[model samples]
Target: MKKTLNINIGNSIILIEEDAYEMLTGYLNEIKFHFSKNADHFEIVTDIENRIAEMFREMLLQQQKQVISIDDVQLVIAQMGSVKDFENADEAEGGIYEETISGVKKLYRDTDDAYIAGVCSGLGHYANIEAKWFRLMFLVSFFFAGSGIVVYLIMWILIPRAATRSQRMYMKGEAVNLHGFIRNFEEELAGNQLISRSRGFFVELAEAAGRIVRTLGKTFFKVVAWLIIILGSCFFLAMLVGMAVFLGFSDANPNEYFPLNIVNDAYLSSMVFAFFVALAIPIIALVLFAIRVAFNSRAINRTVSFGLLVVWLGGVMLSIFYITKVASEFKEEAEFSQVRELKKYDAYTLTLDRSRFFSRADSVKYQINSDKYRGKVILNDMDDPYNLPRNVRLNIEKSENGLVTLTQNNSSHGKTFEAALSHAQNIHYDFSQQDSLLNFSPFLQLNRNTKWRDQEVTLTLKVPVGVKLILNEEMDLFSYSFDYWSCEDHGAPKAWVMTEEGLKCTKP
Candidate 1:
C-alpha cells in the first residue's frame, strides 16, 4: 500500500501515489520552463495543464483505478511527448512538428469556420473533403422536401462543439502531443487562414438569416409550447369528462348504437376504460412535455413518468386484444331468402313507409299500453342518431313466369355459419300492401340485446311485362338497381313500365 496524496491541478483535484505525483510535477515543470520564454506562455501552460487533468480523469474512469500509479504517469508523459522530443523537431520555430503517430479524427463543430453551425465543416474534416462540397450538397438537397434543413439541425444538436484547443486538434486529425500542442497555440496566436477567410455575399446573407431565425425561434417555440399546454389540458379534461359520462350513464345503453353495438357487452366497460387510458395518457404526456418546455422544469418525477408509460402500454395491449376478439366475430357470413306472391294488378304504386314497428319488449321498455295506444303509430325519423345504417335495398325486374312476386334476401356475419344464420334470422323487416299501394321499411331492426353483425336486407320485385308502376320520390334511397335520378324528368310520382330490357321510365 503506497502512500497517496491529493493534489490540485488545473482547478481539478486528483489523488496520486507519491512517485506518480513527483513524476507529474516534474513533467509539468519542464513544460512550463520550456514555454516561459514565449510571449503567450501562461495561456499555453494553462491549456496543457487542463488537457493533462482531463486525460488523468479519463484514465481513472476507463481503468477504474482509485489513485494514479507511476505507470499511468509514464503513459501520459509518453503520449504528450517529452520536452527533448519537441526541441529535436525539424521546424521548431515555424511550429511545424513531425508526424510521430497517426491520430484518429473525431467529428466536432468548427465554430471558428462556421457560417451557421459548422455541421458541414465538421463533416468535411471527418470525411477528408472540402467544406464547400458539403455546403453545396446541403444546399441542393434543401429543395428535395427540405430534408437538408432537418438533417443539418439534427447533426448540429448531436455533434459537440470544439471549445478547447486539444479538442480542435483532435477534430482536425492532429496528434495530441507537445509538438502539436505548441503548433496549435502558435497558429491561434498568429491567426490561421481558417479564421481570416472572407465570406461571400450569399454566405453572409445566410449567416445573417440564421442569426435572425435563431433569435426569433426561441420566442416562437415558447408560444407554441404554451398553446400546446392549453390545448392539451383542455383535450385531456374533455376526455375525462367523456369517459365519465359514458361509464356513468349505464341506463342509456350506449351499446345499442351502431358502432358500439359491434362490441360484446361482456367486456364493453373494460374496452372503453382501456381506450380512455390509451388515448388520455398521450394527451397527458404531451401536456407535460409542453410544460417542461414552457417552464424549463419537469412536472413529474422519473418514477411517475415510468409508471405512466407502463399503464399506457397496458392499455394499448388491452385495446388490441379486444379489437382482435371483436373482429373474430365477423369471420363467417350467412344469408337466407323468402318469396311472397302478390295479388294480380295491372298497375301498382311503391312508396317508403316511415311508420315504426314496435315489439312487445320495446313497448314494455317505453311503458306504452297496447290497448291505450291502439291505432296510433310511432313515426321513426330517418335521422335518429340511435338508428343503424340504411340496410335495405330494392330492385325491380321483369318476371320470368309472368307472375307478380317479391323476394327478400337477408344476410349477416358471425364467428360461425350457424351463428351468422341466427343473426340473419333475428333481423326484422316490414312490407305491406293495401290495394294498389306497396310500402317498404327504410331500415332493418334486430332483436332486443342482439349485437350488430353487418345485418342487411335486399328486396327484389318481379313484375310481368307491360305492367306499369308509379314510384315515390323517397323510394330512390333504397334502389341501387338503376339510375333512379335519370327518371326524375318523367314527372312527380315517377312512372315506369316493365319492358323486355327491364324497367324503363314512362313518358311524362
Candidate 2:
C-alpha cells in the first residue's frame, strides 16, 4: 500500500514509488547543481539521465516489474555512484567511483582509430585483444578467396559507430560518471583536436559537405547491398534448380553431350558435383553476406561460415584434379586416310544430307517404327550447334591421274596413338553416290557410349580436267579449305570446274 507517481526522465515515462521518485529527484538535482558551472553541464547531465533511464529499463525488463521500487532505485544509484563518490574519485589517485561501471565495456566502432571503419578497434576493446592481431588475421584471410573483404563489410554494417562521448567511454571500458566525463573533456581540450580547433566559414562548409558525402555514401551502399541480396538470392536459387535437374538426369547418359563427353564416365558424377560445389558455395556466401548488410544482422555463425569455406576449398581442389586428369587424355593425336575410286562422270551434283542414319541401338532408343515409316527419311535437327565441336571439313582438288577419286581422312586425340586411332575409327560419317548425285553428311557421329576425343573427318574429292561439279547452298558449312561463300553467285547454287592447276569456281 504505497503512493506511486509518474515522472519523465530522459524522454522516458517512469512509474516510481513516491519515496523513490523523491530520492531520484534529489540525486539528479545534486548532479545538475554540481555541474552547473561546467561549460558542457547540459550535455553531461543529459547523458547521465539517459544512462540512468537505460539502466532502469533494463532492470524492469530483467526483473519483470513494471514499476520502479526503492530497492531498484538504490541499486541504480549505487551502480552510477553518488555525487560525493565522484568528487572523491576526482581527488583519489587512480581510484574509480564504480569498479563495475568502469568494467562495463560495449562493442562500438572506434572511428577515431579506424583505418577503414574502426571494427577492429571496437572488437579489440570488447575482447581485450590487440587490434593489430585482428587486422593481421583479416589480412591473412584475404588470401583465402577474398573472404575477409565480405566479413569486414558485414561487420561495418552491423556494428554501430561510437558517436557520443559517453558511447566512446563505454567502448573504451571507461566509467561514464561526472569525474570520468570531466577528465575526458579536459584530455580532449589538452590535445587541441577538432573540439578545440577554431573553425572558419570555409572549414565549416567543408565539414558540412563531407558529412553530406558520407551520408550519401552510406545510402548508396545500403542500396547496393539490397540489390545484391535480391539478385544473389535469385541466382543462387537458379543454380540449385540447375544442379537438381543435372543430378536427376545423371542416369540418362548425360555424358553424351559435347562438354560432358570430354570427361570419363566413371568420374563424371564426382566431377559435376565438385564443380557445383565450387560455384554454388561462392554464390551462397555472397547472398548471405548481402543479407547481413541489408538487415544489419548476422545471417550465419562463424563456425558455419568456416565449414562452408572448407567445403568450397575441397570442391575447388577436386575440380582441379579432375580437370588435370581429363586434360591428359588428349596428349597424343592420330590420323588415318582411305582412298576410294568414284564412278566417272563429266558433271556431278553435290548436296548436304540432313537425313539421320540411325543404327539398331538408336532405333531402339528412339522407339522408331520402321514399318510405319519405311520410305520416310527422318531429318536430323541441328538446333544445338554446340552439341559437338565442328568435326567435318571438305576440300575439292584436281585429280593427279585421269580418274576421279575420293579420300576420307579421320583424326582423333587420346592418351596414346593407338587409343587416338581407335577413337578416330569410332567416328561414323555418311557419304553416298546415286547416279550423278553425291550426298555428304553435315556432321560426323560418335559410336554409342564412346567418349569424345576430338574426332574429326576431312573429305577430299579429286576430279579430272574439264569435269564440272554443282554444290548445294548448305554444303558451304563443311567447306573450310575453299572460299565457298566468296564463289557464290546471286541466289544460285555454286558451280566449280577441276582443271590441271586446281578447282576453279564458275560464278556464271
Candidate 3:
C-alpha cells in the first residue's frame, strides 16, 4: 500500500500517492526553472500550475480514481510536453505567436465574463463567435419564448465550468501545450488578443443598458417579494385572529345566517380547519420567500419544502371536498302548503296589527340585518316586527259559496322534500278575527331551529257576492302594494262590495 497525501490543485482538493505527488512537484519545478529565464516567468509558471491542478481535478472526478498514481503524473507531463520541445525556438521571433489552432474544442462554462452562468460564453467560444452575439440571441429568445433562461439553467447544471488556464485554452480551440499556454498568458497580460476586446460606442452603450436593466429588474423583483411577504403575512395574521375570535365565542344566532345554520357543528369545524390550513400554507410560504429575499437569508431545506408542499396540497383537497359537501345541501328542494277557512261574518274588515304579531311567548332579544330581499331588511327575534321579506302575493276573487274563505300557501326549500316541508311548516303566520275585523300579520316568522329557505306566503281572499269589504290604510303593508284611491277627497272612507267580477268601488 502506498501513502497518499491531500493537495489543493487550483481551487480543487485531491488525493495523490506520495510518489505521484513528488513527480508532479518535480515536473512543476522543472517548468519553473525553464521559465525563470523569461521576464514573465511568474505568470507562465502560475498558469502552468493552475493547468496541472485542473487536469488532476478532472482525472479524479471523471475517472473515479481515489488516488493519483505516478503513471497519471507521467501521462499529464507527456501530454503537456517538456521545455526542451520549444527550447530551440528563436528568441528574435519578437514573441509573435503562430496560429496554433486545434479542432478538438471542449465545451465549458466561462466564469470570467459570465452575467448569470457561463453557458453562453462557452457556447460562443465553441462556435467561434462573439459572446455578445450569443447574449443578443438569448435576449431576443427571452422575449419570444422565455425559454432562454430555462435552457441556460439546464446548460449551467450540465456543463463543467472552465476552471483552469489549460481548460480555458482548450475551450477556445487552442493547444494545451506549454508554448500555447505561455503565449495565451502573455497575450492576456499584455491585453493583445484576450477573450474580451475594447468595443465601439454601440457595444459600450448596449453593455450599459444591459447593466441598467439588470439593476432595475433586480430592484423590481425585490419590491414584489417584499410586498408579497407583507400582504401575505397581514392576511394570514388577520385570518388567525378571526379564527381565534370565533373559537373564543360562539355565534349568537346561527339561524340568522341560514346557510351557516344548515352546517352542523362537526362538519363546520372540519371545513373551517381545512380552509385555514389550505389558505395559510401558501401564505406562510410567500412570507418565508419574502423574508429570504429581503434579508438574503438561506433557502429552506429541500426535504422540508417538499413536505410542506405535499401537506398544502392535502389541505387544498380537503378544503375542496368540504366546500362541495356544504354546497350539496342546497341541491334538492320542496315546499309545504295549507289553507284555512274563515268564520262567516256580515261585514269584514282587513287591517295589519303589528302589536299582536310580535307578542310571542319565547321571543329573544336577537336582531340581525339581513340582505335576503331587494333592500336591507331587519330581522328581530323580540319586539321589532320586520323579520323577513314580505313577499305576500294576494288576489281577491268572488266565492261560489256565500261564506268567506281564506287560502294560505306557505313555501320553502331544503335538501330534501321532507326537510323543506318541515322548514316551511315551521313558519308562523296569524290572520285571526275580532268580530268582523280580520287582523293580519305583514311578515312571516321562522323559528330558530328552522333554517331559512326562502320562506314566503301567498294569501288568497274569496269574498261572497254582495258582501261589503273594508280595506284600511294598513292594506298598503301588504307586499303587493294595493293601489286603492281613498284620500282627503273622500275622508269618509270608500267601501268595496264584492261583485260577480271582483271587488267594486262603492260609496259607504
Candidate 4:
C-alpha cells in the first residue's frame, strides 16, 4: 500500500492503494480540465465522473489483490452495457417463446396488501392490462367456477419479477434510457447495492445466509399473495352464486333441507355482511397491495396479512359462540311435559331429551337396584332435532352381573341417564310406607317455592304394597299441590310401583 490513500470518487466510496488513487484522480482532473468550458458540458462531465468512479470501485474488489491496477479499471469499463449495443437488441428480440411471453404478460397474482387484490390493481402490473379489466373479469368469474383467485396466486409465485433495468422499463412502457442516462443509472444502482469487501469467509457465509433468508421470505410472500388472490376471487363468486341461488329458490320451499324455523333475520344479516365483506375486501386490498408492489414500503404487507388472519379467526370463534348460546336458550324455553297416573304403566321409563345436545356425548351407563341394592347409570345422546324428529328412543338392558346399560351409536361427546327396576323380590322400595329415617330437607322446604327458584311439585302419597290402606283426603293432589303443573289430578305418586311377578320403579 502506498501512502496518502483517502479518496472519494463521485460519491462511489472506493478505497484504493495510495498510488492507484493518485493516478486515477490525476486522470479525472486532466479530463475535467479539458472539458471545463464546453457547452452541453456540466452534466456531461459530472455523469462521466460518476461512471468512472463506479467502474473503479468494481475493479478494486474483483481480484482482491492489494493494489487496484489501471488494467482492472479498463476491464470493468469494457463490461458495462453500451447504449448502442442495447439499441441493437434485435438479436435478442425473440429469445423468449412467443406463446410463453403472451401468457406471462396476461397473468396477475396477489402479493402483500394493506387492502385487497383480486381486481385491476394487481392485474395492472402483472398482466400489462389495467387493473379494471382484471377486476371485471374476476367479478364475472365469481358467478361461475370461482376459481380465478386460486389461479392468480399460483401465477404470482411462479412468475419471476422484472429484475433488470431494461426489463423494468419495458414492463412499465418507459423509453430506453439515453447513453448518459443509462450510465448514470448503472452507477446509481451499484451505489445502492454495494458488495462487502470482507476477507473473512464466515462473514461472507453469514451475509449469504441473510440473503437466502430474504429471498425465501419474498418468494413465500409472493406465493401467498397469489393464493389470496385466487381465494378472494372464489369468495366473490360464492357471494354472487349464493345470492342467485337464494333469489331463484325464494318462491320454492326448502323446508325439507333446513330446520323448521331456520330461516330468520340473523341468517339474512350475516349473509349480507358476508357478501359485502367478500366483495369489498379483495378490491381494497388490491389497491394498497398494488402501491406496495409498484413502489415499496416498510413491510406493511405482513401487517395486513396478520390483521386479516385475526379477523378471520374472530369470525369463526364468534360463530361457534353464537350457535352454542342459541342452542342453550332454545332448550331452556322448550318444555317436556308428561304427567300420568302411576297405575297407567306397570313399569314406567322417563327419558331426557338428547336432541338439545351436540356431538359432545359418547358414553352411556345404567343402574339396576332391588330394595336391597343400588348403583350408577349413564347414557349417550343420539337425539338430533335438526336432522331427526323429536322423539324418545331408548332400550334398556341388564347384564348378568346386575349392571344396566343404555347407549347410542356414533357419538364422541356426551352422557345420559338410565335407570330401571329389577326384581321386586329382593329389591324392595315401598313409596307409600315412607321410612321415618328418610330426610325431606330437599323435598319439602316451604320457603323454597318453585316460582322463587325452588318451587314445589305436588305428588299424593300412595298406599304401601301388602298393607291394607284406607282413603286419605290429603291424597287429593290437585288441591294440596303447591304447583298444580307438577302432578295434575293423576293417581297418587309412588316411591316404588310394584309389578305383578315382581318389578318396581324406584331410584336410590
Task: Tell me, by lDDT, which candidate is best.
Answer: 1
lDDT of 2 by residue, 1-508 (tens): 9999998888999889999998999999999998897789999999999999999999889989889988888998999999899788757644345644556888998777766667888999888898989999899999999999888876776677776776788898886766555667767776786564444555445445445656777788789998988898788788888778887866666677888889998898889889989998998898888788778899999999999999999999999999999989999999999999999999998998878654654555578866665555558646324558888988888887888888999999999989999999888888989888999888887766788898889999989899999997888778467777778588688898887777788964
Instruction: Give lDDT per model, in order.
Output: 0.84, 0.82, 0.72, 0.40
Q: Which numbered prediction scores highest in TM-score against the true structure?
A: 1
Query: Each model's RMSD to truth, in Å?
Result: 13.6, 16.1, 16.6, 24.6
What are the per-residue Cα lDDT tens digits for candidate 4 across 84-177? 4534664545433443344233332322210232224545765566666767776787767778666544444444334344444444444444
lDDT, residue 102, candidate 3: 42
Ranking of candidates on TM-score, top first? 1, 2, 3, 4
Candidate 3, residues 1-508: lDDT per residue as tens digits?
Answer: 9999999876668799999999888888888888887899998887877888888878878888788999889989997887776475434343223334443688997766677656788999999899999999889889977998777656765677775676787788876666555755766766754455454555455446545665676688799998988899899999999776655566554334545555656677667778888989988888888888877895687888889899899989998998777666556666556666787876788876654433232334423323232243233323324345555666667889776787888877667878777777877876778878887776676675555566778888887888887777766657542346632225554477887777777766
Q: Which stretches of candidate 4 lie over 4 Å from their true place?
A: 1-199, 255-260, 263-336, 341-508
Q: How close is candidate 4 to the true structure, as a TM-score?
A: 0.27
Candidate 2 segments exceeding 4 Å error = 1-198, 296-298, 369-376, 380-386, 499-501
